[model samples]
Target chain A: MSRVAAFVFRRKGGKGWHWTDIVTWVWLVGGLFIMFGPAVWLVGSSLKTPAALAEFPPTILPYVTQKVSVEGFDKPFDLYEVTLDDGSKATLAEVRRIGIVSQMVDPKAPGEIIKVNIAQRTPVREMSFATENYTEPFTHFDFFRYLWNSVFVTVVATLITLVVNSMAAFALSKYEFRGRTAAMLVILATLMVPLSVIMVPLYSIVSALGLFNSLWGVILPTVATPTGVFILRQYMLTIPDELVDAARMDKASEWQIYWRIILPLTAPALAVLAIFSVVWRWNDFLWPLIVLSRKELYTLQVGLSIYSGELNVQWHFILAMTVVTMIPVVLVFIFLQRFITTGIAGTGLK
Target chain B: MTIDGSGKTGPRVGEIAMAPVRFAMGLVDAPLRKLQKVAGLGGMATFFLLPNMLIFGIFVLLPFFINFAYSMTGGSALFLSDRSFVGVDQYARLFDCSNYLDPNSCAEDTFWTAVGNTGWFVVLQVTLMIAFSLVTALILNRDLKARSFWRAMFFFPVLLSPVVVGLIWKWILQRQGLLNFGLYGFGFDPYAWLNDRTWSFAAAVAVSIWAHMGFYTLILLAGLQAIPKDLYEAAEMDGTRSMRVFMRITLPLLMPNLLVVIVLVLIRAVQIFDEVYVLTGGGPGTSTLFLTQYIYETGFATQLRNPGLAAAASILMGVVLVVLTLVQLGLGRSSDKNGGRK
Candidate 1:
């Protein structure tokens, strides 16, 4: 074991560490590595050149290109200019390495090859950054468009979710009416209906509603999630009813009460709902994949998936895009982690 | 309705100036209040709930019923009018098999293959997930150094998109990827982690567990925290061994969360699609083709695009989910009753 592992297992005289403590530390550290190492590797690999990425005994760090002199083909091959038969200088287009000879091609004259002595030529190592892996995808593909689509869909869907679910929750919790229990039960029951079951018919419905190939097709179906209703309802139940009665005495309309009084009070719950909603809508894939036939309408997830299939699989580009796609959610999680942890635990218990 | 002693009872100049506006408001309110009186609070409640119920009814409830209806019909059309009614024929086709034990003997052999693959997936995924999550949760519940940071590290992947998670793992597990690179370093030949059938299936399950174990661990951690500290203290006072205390006290107290985790994990395992779809595309001869992927491919991918058969398969999936959910609710109820007794 390494020094850190030894330290982890080490026990002081008074504060003696038991075998279980050592076991626990080992499990925790191992589990954390397995959970977190891939993401770190992803970010690292994204920064490497395609050449360095394909190198045997693959490296974890992005390779820094360094220029070095070699005995054979001593000059930098890419920058070498060849002398043409017509006495014109041509850029070296291709270099092929055989047993003891090097063949260089001049693009200016495709049919002619110039032989270079390997032992006599000076080859220099060229080391530079592969920032192009990050830039090429955006310049060549519709990356920003996908990013914008994701933002729009996530924001609109979350706002609509908060408004609609909170309204329903407000009524369900604040009012006693016939079939109120039944409606609540029905809504809760629908939570059990996994998206897989209703997906086909839901597709048909969206098609029939003339939303095919539209971002609205993706946004509309997810606006009224049962989990949102359940969470907001549970929160809303804790708000004192006397406040609503006081608002009623002020002759505030029902809509006014919901909009001004209840919604403002449920801000914390709304924040939690907003975070969950944004994550769900942003990370959503299958629905958008089905609804968005047009490439321009594809969200980040679908767009990244399409990028995955482009010609050859470019691991560097894919990793870069994955990092790009994860930034927003990570920021959100970091900012509101307290709410997320508590909200999830709360829902699980309930 | 009474005014405060220091407050003015009569309308101010601004209010008097708004008399016409108030009259118009009163005209609107009169009919609304009369309607409220006639229909009562339930009617008002329905009004408040209309928007949510309308969307939910259209998207979820209606589609749920239409899914069943679609399963009973036969055709490839997206519209119901273009299809013909075929009672239970789709179900019959799904269950049609020569040897029930062998998926290849079935007419819809891919469906049975999916069923078989998912069965093994659920078994392995749920078992490993529960065990790892429990162990991790218990460790995190300890008074260790950098405890919060370690907790966040384990929980971070749960926040990632499933597609991203799948892609990350695919990059790591591919033939020339990191795992094989590590093997090469150790003087071992590269193993085709995803290209092979068995390894691909196992990779799918392993990836699922990695992506989701955090959420379940958090649940288990919460359950662990909820276990009263006094119980452990009492056990300590009685000179109970740590192992005995864990077995007798912690395990029993954690049972409710454990049951919830099991059912949730099972349901999610059955619903596994995005990660596996992105990672393996249910390839290498349908070894990792889950039921959800089966439904998606049957309805969307193939040229035939058989909506009826897909609907039937989805309904079958729904049946399993509903049963699991009921068991979850039952567990919740029993736990609640137990809490009440205590």
Candidate 2:
């Protein structure tokens, strides 16, 4: 073989680190940052104060170099003191109180100041890096209530979908009953029908069923996902027939076979479906937005939109809220990412 | 003679009955003997399909039929009061070449314009997305260390909800955003990425790619893996160049996956609503006004009671999608089954 040909034919595994390998490593590692950089920026900025967040070139780590200065408060008298261990206050008179003007108050204030807009509660005196972005949602607002409501709906919807779809998939896969092909066709063909066509009517149906704004509102419509059933059925078909037959020989019922034998074998496939359902439910914005009207019942995605107005957006708050909201999904993905990648690809094969 | 005939018939009948009993007993020991030879089949089929059937029927089948029915009516809240049967009036009004009654009492040209914009977006976004994903997948699939980690990194963006993706990217592209900050560092002037009409559309498409190309990448990677490595080795032995190998082997083998990805992406891009809704909100004078978002605006966003119009628009969009999806499936199936051989 020619030298070039020999080099090309050489098994890649045995090739010690070469120029190509080094370039590939750089590209791969750099590519990781390219993919995750925006997300990192988003989550990082979320933890920052509005001023720190607006800093040019953007800092990933907390800003320790700059102390934020607040101005424009009418009252400026100062004699700041913190009591030492002796319990006698010795004054350090140079420090003065500065009130940062929140967006809630206008610059053209005084007459425009509404009683409802005032920050009546005492502000935190400490300057420190904290998880207030997360905890504040729990303490200061009904963010937890919204989160609970979202969780309740998503969990219920996903579980119901899994059960119903799995059963359907099982029936379609295993049975040679009448209209079997027709039933499968009906399920598959519906995949093409755009969800927009049914949004209005589905909304009307939910209202008609008296399920609007209730947990049932979210759960009922999403149950029995044809896609899920299709996936589960496809997965179930891969199971060996003899395993099921052995169970039948032991006088075990069909349900017993499903619960004990089939479901266990399908765990890998089910894990994939679980990730899909969780991510989809967690990120679902439109359907939930349509179904839910009450602020307290809003999902994280929907509630986050309230901070996003027609024109003006509070970037700091939105980023903070976004970071907070992404936590559960990120955690879920981290735990189940492997299953997620394998499941869809594997299921798609059938 | 009569007694002889009766004795002969009885003897024949008794022999036949004994034969049948032996056959029945022979079958008794087998597991499925009691089940009419298809024992668990009926029950098991029901278990597999029952859930999907129920859900699909209620959510999918029912909605399809309902939309078909709604398409026939003049279906606005106000029009509901009129209660007049307008056979194909809505679909007609959608394409009525003359001045249809706008609330402003002027000519409203919605169909052609919306169709034009949607067509452009579908063509642009789908092609870009597929090309982007395929290239990325090819690069990633190359013999490299830490392939799994890099794969995960590329695929991570796919995990983000479109809504969240829009919100995050919007921040990045905002006037005082990271983009501007970075530009300022290099002494370059900041540009309006999402605010300008042309740029807004591009920005929307860019966001769609960022949010979803990972999915296509996975699909393409799978396709790449399926290609026989032996083919590449054989080509190399014959002194076939790298580019030639890619063109001849890789591209052709990857066609099936490419078709699927293209079709899926096209259909999805045409119906895109969430990202545009979050990012530009179909702004800068409707430069980024996609058909789905247009329907949304007419129905929900604009606070106008033109749901009838919105419904009409949605049905039209659905028709377009259905046609596209059907064509894709038809072409895709035929190509895979026969194209390579020919």
Candidate 3:
């Protein structure tokens, strides 16, 4: 009887084990899908034309092609034959101007239109899958100039930030002066005060200085970021004082010490800070939006917002633009990842 | 370590002997030695700091004073000639200046509402963000395979622009967005995530967490790695369970980092604008209208051009931020002391 009971218990245990193993596998797959699914969709959507994007069910890949329109308008008016009394057929351009629905285009079915109106589907017309979104701007159907400006601003800003921030950090870290603590405290204090607090005043200052609509308008205010100063100073502090003293004793000038001794040693930290600064300045939206009034001066972020405006947000173009904007940041991140982990760990600084 | 003829230990002779005669050099060298001890040894410190000081004064300090002055006067959008010297009246108007057009607009209510909404946003976002990041950090720091890959995956969100974050999440959470599409597929009714009054507020808080978790994770992971391995070994030898070990050892050790992360998160959460702007545009109703957004609309939005009110709002926001920072720093200090004791 005891052996019989033991056998029964063993059988139940085996069944439970089998059940849990199946459940665990299901959960593992489900969790990963949930986490990485959006990233995969973003990449996939960028390759899709408007027709293929976010259609009723998401597609596994972007494989659809769109038809081109070529045979619409040779003569201005075919009115008399068609309408008799009115005799004037509305030209394609005139129809478009008066908000008439296109003849070839289907007026969305009532149910579908309601869903689209409710924000389910973004209704950008499908176009041929060319890289025109990346190149064409004269016709203004897509982005080209805004991307160029973003690249210019990012490269210029990153270079300037590295030099200015490193210099300030070197001074703060190596020197022990009467106002050193006070200066450090002030920088830290700025971290607490958000830019929103002084944005109006900042705008007024920029306007007064006549920097509106210029690249310098965006670049100048951010040159003195408190966060950069904090990061650089902390990294510099970990450098031994003896090195500077030794360099000085050898008759190396302060500038020489900064250029040769200190700069070389802090390369890893500087790289990390550079990545931080570049990514931030490149991706900045608000300040750039306010400073650059001219459409031509808009950076990638602000331009992307304009592309997303309610009247005409071309999802395909927007996604393509997103891909274009993200590529540089992604490449920089991959390059900096090796140094960044150490920097973040606080080990590299010391 | 082989030394060359010049040697690495001391400065080369010419650097020390820039002056003419040996007699004058000796006289100059003695007093200069004392000057070199404190600030940048000798004259080195003064010159290196000169540029930084000038920039800091002009950009940071001078503006700080100006901000205070503007707060005092009823600052206008117009130039100095058009400004008036209404001392403290501007500050008073902050509470009383309701409908600039309507006599009964009740300005004080709007200001107070903004304050309440901002506070709620900070509380919800900071707590949720810290929780998400701490969990991710703990999981990533575990002695598991593919730890590095997971760490990289988790940290990727921080690399994206906040505007991108806002936009991506906006696409997902809009009334008929991916969330509803997914839900519909699963046979549930579609929920409006961005347009509903309550859901809009909640969605903003959620976006702040998703965007910020990576930075906090990095900070916490550093703190986690700093804990010595011996403690864990000892806990195991004493037959303590994993949960007990984490509670007794890891929690105490990680407190300093937690304080840093918390304070930073709080400060950032209060200043959230980019996500708020791109997501709902503070819409449906005033449900998602954050303080910064309110100030932005007042000062810059095409429809609402109230520079004086905006300035007052900004000054008020600044004061609140400063006070909150001070309080957090104090709490952080006490917690740090407790951590040291453990």
Better of 2 and 3 by lDDT: 2
Screening candidate 3 with a backbone cut-off below 3 angstroms (N, C-alpha, C), the clashing residue pairs are A79-A87, A79-A88, A79-A89, A80-A87, A249-B11, A250-B11, A250-B12, B36-B41, B36-B42, B98-B107
lDDT of 1 by residue, A77-119 (tens): 3434445556665445335778766687554454667775455
- Candidate 1 on B61-121: residue-level lDDT in tens? 9999999999999989997778899999999999999997799899999999999999999
TM-score of each: 0.87, 0.79, 0.77
Off by over 4 Å in 3: A1-35, A63-142, A310-312, A347-350, B1-44, B97-105, B108-110, B189-192, B331-342
Model 1 chain A scores worst on lDDT over the 10 consecutive residues at A65-74
DockQ, in order, for the candidates? 0.33, 0.21, 0.23
Residue-level lDDT of model 2, residues B1-52, one tens digit each, is: 0112223333343334234433543454354334424645575556456656
After superposition, candidate 1 runs with Cα above 4 Å error: A1-13, A64-96, A100-127, B1-42
lDDT of 3 by residue, A226-306 (tens): 767777677678779999889878986566677567765665555566666778888888889888878889898988776
TM-score of chain B of each: 0.88, 0.78, 0.78
Error of 2 at B52 (Å): 3.3
Report the Cα lDDT for residue A19, model 1.
82
- Candidate 2 Cα errors over 4 Å, as ranges: A1-30, A57-60, A64-130, A310-313, A348-350, B1-48, B78-84, B97-113, B335-342
